[model samples]
Target: MRALLTTGTPPTWTVTEIAPPAVAPDQVLVEVTTAGLNRADLLMREGAYVPSSADWNVGPDRVGFEMAGRVRAVGDRVTGIAPGQYVMAQTGGACAELVAVDHRLLLPVPDPQDLVAAAGLPSALLTEYDALTGAARFRPGDRVLITGGAGGVGHIGVQLARALGARTVIATTRSQDKAGLLRELGATRVIDTASEDIATALGPDAFDVCLDHLGGPVLAGLLGAAAPRARIVQIGRLAGTHAHLDLETLAARRIQLIGTTFRGRDTDELHALNARVREALPGLLRTHDVRPVVDSVLDLSEAERAGQLLDRPGLTGKVILRIVA
Candidate 1:
């Protein structure tokens, strides 16, 4: 089997022959068809985000976060799934020809859809869903603001918020070109954070929910733009994690500031999120609405290129790795 090996260095990815992963009694063996690259993948390569397990390979680690594939074998205890079943899963070490995944994290691929596009959905969509519904508790007619609005999670977040009946969806992008694209994707208003001030564009106490993908000054500004009793869900820190917050302002307006990350979810929690996404998948995919935003697809051998591309500025969506059989 061939896999992308990250040697704990930038501008380098080695495709090496590695043994296939053995399926544990509680895991299923998947023949990966495509794998999705995420911002976390880049951080992990730079020795920033380490996996929970020490034994897990770090440098020269097999890298990949989300994948769309077919079940080649199922564990003894795994039920309701079998060989030849097409599925998408969230797992580490997915940049390989094979992956041993917990059955709970596997979701049936939607019908009449491209598997390549499906590859980009698991991590971004699940994170957005969790941030909006699970953490933020957004309701219909709510005015929601999403920072980093044109990035992978932000674009999807915009669509999901709209689909869930958010009355006014406001998205912020540092790139000027993406503002129009964000509006086309269901955002009622798009603010270019590079020049325009979010606080001024949206008057004080304007938004019911604020989804912050970019932290630092941008997040601070968002806090000032929140409506009374609003929810501020911080899902990413692309611009730097450290940010100043006015506790008095937050308390005075009854605002909730939540900082969240999905990398540490246990199998049970991952399964629960998967189930909720599964229920919502049919409607979202059937309408060809809220599709995964894929910026580019590279061959598996080009994993390094994908990583570099993700680091580039002005990226509007996900970068997927097309794994050849």
Candidate 2:
């Protein structure tokens, strides 16, 4: 079997042959069709990102976080999935031709499989799902704000915010070129932070719920723009790790600043979270109003090209790695 590896001090992606993963009792063996690249993979390459316990392959292996494929086999204890079923999941070592993922992590791919598109959905879906529904405690008719609206997760966040019934869905992006796409994805307002000020563009007390991935100065702006008692869920620190915020506004508004990450979460916690997504999948998928925005599709050997896209400020949506059959 061919698997991707990350070797050297500052890791680099490599494709090599490795023993196929043995399916665990509660797992399913999937023949990967396509995989998605998240910005976190960039951190992993630089020895910055740590693997979640749920990730199957750690160390230097080409560690892809999510994929969409067809089920080749199922473990003894696995139920509700069968061979030939198309599925997608957020899992470790997804850069490989095959991966044995816990059945709980697998979500059925819509029929007439558009594996390329499905490839990009899981990571964004899971991250934003938990961030909005769990950390931010989003409710229907709440005015929602998603920073980095053109991003892999943010675009999905935009659609989810609107699909779930937000009164207003405002998305912020540095790429003005993506403003129209963000609006198409359901953002009521798209603020280009490259030229516009987030706080000034949105005004005071504008957002009832904020799902922020860019910390640093972007986060500081969110503090000023947030409504009283608003929940600001911090999901990533892409902009920077540090921020000088206004304690006065924070206190005055009685805002709840929440932080979330998937690193080091135990199997039980992951199972529960996956279940949360499954429970809401019906409503979220039934409308068919939400979908991942795919920017490009590359082969597994094109890992470097995929990784480099993360550095481009104009990059919009997910980069998928298609493993040609």
Candidate 3:
């Protein structure tokens, strides 16, 4: 099997031959068709985000969080899914020809014909869904705010909020060119962070819920503007991890601040979370309401190029690595 392997600090990755993973009774073996490139992959490569599971350290295939593939084999206990079925899953060691994923975690590709785009859906969708519904406890008719709205998770977050019946959805982006795209996706208002400040643009006490991806100083300012008793779910820290919170403001407004990640969860918890997403995803996809954005698709062997594209500033949507076909 050929996989993208990472080497050294500020790591560089390349396609190399590696042993295929073995299947456990609760797992299904998949012939990977495509894998999604995430910021976590880039961070992991650069030795910033370490894998939370030991399986990721088992071999040269150091990092793969999400993939779309065809089920090639199923363990004895695995049911409902069999060989030749198209599916997507969240699992480590997915940047390879074959990967073994827990049967419970496998998701039916909403659009079976376009597995390439489907590959990019798992991480972004699962992460955002959990943040909005699980952590933030978002309700229909709530006013929502999504930071870094042009990025992978951010774009999808916009659409999901709207599909969930959010009364108002506001998103922030550094590029004005993306304002139209963000609005088309579901955002009622798009803020160009380059010129206007987010807190001022949205106005204080404007949003009922905020799905924050870009943390740091910006988050602190945004917190001050959240509606009373509003919920803010912190999904990613692309801007910077550290943020100073105003305890007084939070207490005065009764705002809830939550931090969430899939990496920290156990397998059972992940499976449960994915199950919730799986239930909601098909409906949204069927209606063409929430679509996963794919910036580009590169061949699996061009792993280094994919990494480079992801690293480039102002890149929007998910970068996919085509493993087969």
Candidate 4:
């Protein structure tokens, strides 16, 4: 088996031979076709976001969060899935030729033929769904704003909000070039943070909900821009953690500030989130109104290059790694 391993250093990834993962009774052994590169992978490699288990070797810490593949074998207890079934799953060992994933976390792949593009869908889409529906409780006709709209999760967040019937979708991106792309992804207005201030693009108290992928000063600005009784979901801190908030303003407007992260959830919680996402998968993909935005596809052996590309500023979407035959 070949996998992209992290060498416990910043901005580094290496492709090397490794043993295939052994399947548990509730797991399915998959022949991975593609893997999605995520920001978490970069952080974990840099030793910034360590999982609960601290003893695991960094080398085998295979770096990927999502994958699309064909099931090669299913454990005895695994039901509803069989060998040769194509699927997408949220799994840790995805930057490899083979991975064993819990059947509960797997979703059947859509009719589309490109498994590589499909690989980037699960994590980003599910995170956006959870942020919009689960955390923010967004309703139809709501005016929504999303920070980092050109990035992987932000791009999907913008589209999902529109699909869920948001009357107006506003997005913020540092790249002016991506403004048009964001509109194509369902944003009614795209704000180029490099040239325009979000507060200026959108008047004060204009949005019913704001999804912040970049915390710190940007997040504080988002909080200040919320409409009365607005709901703000904080999901990522790409800028930096620690942001000052105006408690008086938040209280006066009856605002709701909620913070969530999907990666650290317990098994049962993750199972529930996965199930909800699976139920919504058909409609999400079938409409073709909103799908994962794939920026580029690289061979499995080019994982380092993929990581570097993801790290570069002004990326408009996900970078996928093709892993299989």
- lDDT against the true structure, per candidate, is 0.83, 0.86, 0.85, 0.83
Q: Is candidate 3 or candidate 4 better by TM-score?
A: 3
Give per-residue CA lDDT, model 3, range 1-325, as digits (tens): 8887797655778787877888889888999999998988888776668677422424533667889989999999997998999999877867889988888788899777998888998888888888888899999999999999989889999989999989999999999988988989999998898999888777778899999999998788787679999999988887888999889989999999998876557766877887898888778787755778899999987888888898787688899999887
lDDT of 1 by residue, 1-325 (tens): 8888776335367788987887878888888888888887887777788765312322337687788988899999988898998888777777788888888777777642577877888878888998999999988889999999999888999998888899999999878889788988899999987889998888888899888999987888877789999999988898878888888888899999988886556656777887898888777767748777789999987887888899899687989998865
Model 3's alpha-carbon lDDT is 0.85
Q: What are the models' TM-scores?
A: 0.94, 0.97, 0.96, 0.94
lDDT of 2 by residue, 1-325 (tens): 8877888766688888888888889989999999998888888778788776674444545678999999999999988898999998889888889999999888877443689988899889989988888888899999999998889988999988888899999999887789899989888898989899999887898999999989999999888898999999999888989999999999999999999988888888888888888777767877755788889899988888888886777788999998856
Model 3, poorest ten-residue lDDT window?
A: 53-62
Which segments of model 4 are wrong by more than 4 Å? 8-11, 52-60
Choose the strongest candidate by lDDT.
Answer: 2
Which prediction has more favorable TM-score, 2 or 4?
2
Candidates in order: C-alpha RMSD to true structure: 2.3, 1.4, 1.6, 2.3
Error of 2 at 142 (Å): 0.4
The stretch of ten residues in a row with the least summed lDDT in candidate 4 is 51-60
Best by TM-score: 2
Question: Which residue ranges in model 3 land beyond 4 Å of their true spot?
Answer: 8-10, 53-61
Clashing pairs in 2: 4-62, 5-62, 6-60
What value does the lDDT take at residue 305 in candidate 4?
A: 81
